[model samples]
Target: MVVGYWRLAGITSGLACAAGALQAQLLVRAALGARHTSTLVHDSIITPFVLRPALAPALAVTAATPLDERWTAQVTLDFSTSTLERHDADGTTTGLGRVSTLAFTVGLRRPLGAGFAAGAGVGGLKYLPAGETGIFRSGAGGVLGLAGAVVSYAPPRVGGRWQLGIEARYDVHRFITPALRSEGFTSARTVHRIALALRAGRGGAAGAAGAAGAAP
Candidate 1:
């Protein structure tokens, strides 16, 4: 587990630095009047669901914010009530109960432009795995401190009105707690999401209305 985390951290740092440097250069050039560009910054929520042959359904939510035209910062909250069921060779059934977690992540989103984007991110998942029956416990030990990356594509908009996007993420974290505490397991979770918004005000507008630092 320690080795896995080390590798993930190293990879995420390398990729984020490389991508951030490149994008910063482009943004600087565009800002210097060398070219025309429109940067987009926005936020949205994530909803995750699971439906399989023998597992109960589950759902999770995530909150994300754009750091730049090609980077974003995010915080995700995961909650689910689906447990794993096992059938013994003697026709006996056992339930593993429900599992839940809350994870916070600091990630970078790289936009490919033309309504497309891709990037990688790394963060830690903080959650209390359930141990007892329908009650929430803080020490069941499910998944703790995980790292992940995401690739996304969205509709390019000129005036920050409405945009549609699709994203996929791979997460490596602890899976089962209690019995095994080997820093969890590496699980890859993918998400598909949509967003909608209306821009009616901004800091610029507020400043203008308040007449701060205005030349008489």
Candidate 2:
């Protein structure tokens, strides 16, 4: 975990330096939505362990800068938490627990239409057990590689500096725990989410020229 944090810090610092040199337009976006997550565990000597679909609230914050008229570079941070329950062979509930995740991604976005855009990126994810016990109890928390895609729409300028939009995102990653590995198991986690966001920033030719002129 400590090493993971250091890696994230280094990546962030490098991006900050690059942003400064490019004189990229600064844009901040905040979103809120619901997330659905599921995990599939493969184990030797037994059937796979599939967790029930877990649905929870999701939130995200993003910082973006235009690389050109049609492309933008951005970094996003997302979070979600949910309760999961295990089922017995007969489909009866055996135990229940909680899991939470934090993810960071850096990706590129391209305009799809006048008000729509799409993006794809890769980053890192961390999973933590939240008040979880029983068979799912594993103090092991680890970080893994993550990849995601996003589709968003922002209405034309609403007479202000802020623009409102809707976004849908999907993420894929792997989750493995000491407890699972101890039992010889590996898991894959997937998340789907949708959100409404407010974007505040400037871009395009005029914005780029201004930013470049202000660069040191």
The TM-score leader among the candidates is: 2
Which 10-residue window in model 1 sums to the lowest lDDT? 28-37
The models' CA-based lDDT, in order, is: 0.37, 0.65
lDDT of 1 at 141: 48
Residue-level lDDT of model 2, residues 1-216, one tens digit each, is: 999999999999999998775554666677777876655342323644455436777788887777766677789999877776665455566436776778899998877766677889999987666654543467545677888998887766542445556788887776666666666555544443443343334432346423322110
TM-score of 1: 0.44
Per-residue lDDT tens digits for candidate 1, residues 121-173, read: 55565434355532223254444555665444444443342223344444555
Model 1 regions more than 4 Å off: 1-69, 78-81, 87-94, 127-138, 157-162, 181-216
Q: Estimate each model's TM-score.
A: 0.44, 0.70
User: Total backbone clashes of model 2?
Assistant: 0
Q: After best superposition, candidate 1 residue 154: deviation in angstroms?
A: 1.9
For residue 114, model 1's alpha carbon misses the true position, in angstroms, by: 3.2
